[model samples]
Target: MGLLCYGSVGGVMASLILVFSVMWVGGVGGVGFHERGSVMKWSGIPTALSLFAFCYSGHSVYPTIYASMADKTKFSRVLFVSFAVCTINYGVMAVVGYLMFGQATKSQVTLNLPVENMSSKIAIYTTLINPLAKYALIITPLVNAIEEWLQVSKSRFIGILIRTVILISTVIIALTVPYFGYVVALTGSFLSSSATMVLPSLCYLKIFKSSRRWGLELVMILAILVVGVFIAVIGTYVSMKQIVSSL
Candidate 1:
């Protein structure tokens, strides 16, 4: 199920890239699709690169991958290979996309992607091929939460009910929220800072007695936390500006 979900995400990303390429070739341009009042202001390329780095921040699955492996030494080897492939692919795409669309790459890429507009035939086919994929994406975390709360008393029926309620609540909130990016940025700020930076370093420092090595790791972690906080602030401010402008 996890593998299938990963495959679907990869497919979606590939399809979006293809769509971006098409739009670039078709000469579409501009940041018109971004929410109103989004500031284009930035210090320089360094800031632009920092924002671009956020897209690569979803490396949380690395621990799961490492846990699944039988041989621990293979972890570094696997990571190196995987990182190389991802870096090459992302770098090539970014360069090609930038050259093709220049400053409009991000907007063009987001606007041209049309997964929501999938044809009925394709949607039906995907439903048949991966019947549980979409439901699992929405429901799995809810199920886990229910299991945590109910302990051994939780049943499949209970899980399903919990999942349904959560799904409904999410849909309602999504509908009510005027700007999703704002919600995303605010939530992401909290999650990214703690998960990516703060908590990990704390865990390592407390659990591992390797003081010298852990000190360096703590430094790196603090750096990440600082940057994460900065980005989150900027994202939240921009989102608020957008909301105010719309009103």
Candidate 2:
């Protein structure tokens, strides 16, 4: 956000958002698409599914955003719309990007873009400023929760101290981790799966008190919970092994 204070980062981001699809498509065309005629490894399915879980993990922010919405009843509608948009955007990017680069794709797709291409430069520039914009939003909830639990003062000094400490701790951890992408994938696999899929189902099962234990609805939810836990445990182990090997 500091960049927004002194530069046209917001405008640039807006422009990028507006043209991102077009640019992705055009850039894919310009760079050329190739088919490897190869199959994805079965061993990679867990990590791939975990990454998809991360993509759908916007549910974590729903409570905060919903609280700020003017029409509370319309929250479900807003969620549907948001996810629909995201599905389209992510689907297009995934399909086009994969078709364009195939198995050669990197964790950050833009990094796979041709170095000489303007599209690549724009992608790199957008990426540079994205973290600045995302940092506050990502950390604010955790900070607020911690402050509330500790009954910390709402004063600016206390707030700044808390945010700074949290930021520094995360930065330190990130610096220590050699493969940032693997760490993200691991987190998404373990934490995001529970947050996005398991908890919600369990919460619903508990809150509604469904009497039919053998009913299809209950059975499906039970299956989801089991699968979620399985994925979390297995995925974390796999990701940790990969991270260790990288080191």
Candidate 3:
């Protein structure tokens, strides 16, 4: 829908749709986690890290969004606002969802809802449709990049072919893996750490080369990179191990 409509307006509508859907999740009151399973364990660290990385993985599209912005200099402010909104939304969902399902929460929270209920039915349909609505918007950059690389931007036939191939490939991968949580963890661990954590810090250091060498900022940036690399390595190992075992 966003791709069919104006990009900016469609984006807003998509976001609004999500906001309304989330309200239903919280409004359908939850049973507290009384007599529930254990709340914390040391074994959850890697999965927790993977989820955090996934939440912050929007950086891959920052360049495209910045290019579309009217004022590039205000991009940082816009990005900050975006992250803040996402953080609040995720926080609320996390609390409400955990309260509702406790230890039994599914990878996709919608799965936890009662399928027979009307509201759950609505949510399930909306959730299913939401991805289709945003699919074009999400893949436009990749498709354009491929067209540009192949110098086929003017060839409508080639453009369609490229998109079709990419879509088919994506479906094949999804079908092959079939495990939602494992795929999320694998992607977040293998790719998102570099995009969301390491590269930004390294870019900052490079851009601000005039700053005092061996300063606190440099140390902190290096530390961030190190931590990112550590997480990526460990998280990928964990995810791969889990994937292999599931096979």
TM-score of each: 0.59, 0.83, 0.84
**Count of clashing pairs, candidate 2:** 0
Writing each residue's lDDT as its tens digit, candidate 3 over 96-187 gives: 66766777878887888766666566667766666666567677778878889999999999999999999999889867766688779878
Model 1 quality (TM-score): 0.59
How well does candidate 3 match the true structure in TM-score terms?
Answer: 0.84
Off by over 4 Å in 1: 2-142, 152-154, 174-184, 212-218, 233-235
Worst 10 residues of 3 by lDDT: 28-37
Q: Pick the candidate with the highest lDDT.
A: 3
Q: Write model 1 residue lDDT over 123-145, tens digit each, in one string.
A: 33433444243445435544665
lDDT per residue as tens, model 2, 7-80: 43353354346347335545563765554545667888778777777777766456666676667899889778
lDDT of 1 at 134: 40
Provide backbone clash counts, one per model. 0, 0, 0
Q: lDDT scores for all predictions?
A: 0.53, 0.72, 0.73
